[model samples]
Target: MELTILGTAAAEGWPALFCACDTCKRARAVGGKNLRSRAGVQFGKTHRVDLSPDTWYQEAHLGADMSALEYLFVSHSHDDHWQPHCLAYLRPPFAHANNTPVQVYGNEAVVRTGRAELGAEQTIAVFNEVAPLKPIPAGEMTVTPIVASHKVGEQCLNYLFASEGKNVLCAWDTGLYEDESSWKFVENVRLDCVILECTCGPSKCERYHMDYEHYLAFKERLEKAGSVSSECIFVATHFSHNVGILHDELEQYFSPHGVCVAYDGMKIVL
Candidate 1:
């Protein structure tokens, strides 16, 4: 499986749309991986996680071909992660020669919102409501949703993707592993790659998102639990400008721990 980090920044983006903060200024002056868009990831050629507002920019700048996308797994209903408005382009004159409808999998809220926004474009998009822990066949792969502690009343989720003897854990917009069921489920699975969010950066916040410390702890716990092996690749993504750091700084902090700080267009093949 080939996993591509389409965009790495959190909701507001790295060099936020309208901000004069020092971090944003630094990102603008040193434009490379430091300048990031909203969060999204593409798995292999046809499957993707999240649909940010920056999808068009990523497609144009990163040379992504969205027309080939067949599966879209949404983490939550947050605007930065799930931009249903972009589905309009999947239909009518905007997109052509795409006979395959993109099967979108998500929680109740995500399904409802997607249907409300893209129902008229049923020819190109289909929403499938997925429950936690239930494995669903997606093309050649099997995906299981894990409950995430990101929202109070919403059923936000992380995902476990298994294919070709490799497993991937996409854990974003989540705090610590407070759910015992999720922990137990992951404990028995061997993960080749784990994508974790460092939205709080160096700080320690466990309310809705995790920080660098929390990330390290989680990695340690996973390793100790035998879920992740020595060869497992750990990646830190989903950055926030409020974290007050750029890609280079993040690399400097996380590199020694064998964690790759994800930048836009970064790809990991397993």
Candidate 2:
């Protein structure tokens, strides 16, 4: 499976659209990887996790082709992650020679929110409500949704993608593993690639997101539980300007721990 890190910033994006903070200024000056978009990832042009508003920009600037996307797995209804407006382009004059209806998988809110956006007249896409621990077959992999502690009154999810002999954990927008069921499910599966978020950067956040410390703790806990493969690749992404850590700083902080810092357009083949 080929996984592409499409966007790596938190909801507000690094160097947020409307902020003149020192960190944002530094990000602007650094340019390159320091400048990030909202979070999302694509697997082999067919399976994608999250549908950020930056999808179009990623496609144009990063050379990502989503015209062949078949399955879209949404984490929650957050606009940064689930921008259903893009679905409009999937059909009509915007797209040509593509008749495959994109299958969307998410929780109840995801379904409702998407439906509300597309309305009753829309086609070219189908929404399937996904539940935690319920594995569903994709083209060549099985997607298992895991509960994530991000939003209250919403069934937020992290995903475990198992294909061939490799397992990938897409845990962006996730906090510490608090639910027993979530932990039990993760404990049994061996992860080869972990795409976890370090949204809070240097700050300490254990609720809706993770910080640099939380990233280490999460990795340590996974190691202690013996759930990671010997050659597992751990990546830290989903940055925020609030914490003042740019891409280089992130690399400096996480590199020693064998955790890679993801940048926009980064691709990993497993």
Q: Write the per-residue lDDT of candidate 1 for residues 1-270, one digit (tens) a residue.
A: 887898898898889889999999999999999989898888867888999999999889986667788999999999999988788787667778464688999999998998888766676788899989999899899999999989999989999999999999999999987899998888889999999998999876858899988899889889999999889999999888888877888889999999999989998999
Give the TM-score (vs. native) of candidate 2.
Answer: 0.97
TM-score of each: 0.97, 0.97
Considering only N, C-alpha and C atoms within 3 Å, which residue pairs clash in candidate 1?
none
How much lDDT does each candidate structure score?
Answer: 0.89, 0.89
Among all windows of ten consecutive residues in candidate 1, which has the lowest summed lDDT?
91-100
Worst 10 residues of 2 by lDDT: 91-100
Instruction: Give the TM-score (vs. native) of candidate 1.
Output: 0.97
What would the per-residue lDDT of candidate 2 be over residues 70-143, giving only the tens digit for each residue? 99999999988999878877876888737468899999998988888888635778989997999999989899
Candidate 2 local distance difference test against the native: 0.89
Enumerate clash totals for all models, in the order shown.
0, 0
In model 1, where do residues sit more than 4 Å from their true spots? none
> Cα deviation of 90 in candidate 2 (Å)?
1.1
The lDDT, on a scale of 0 to 1, for candidate 1 is: 0.89
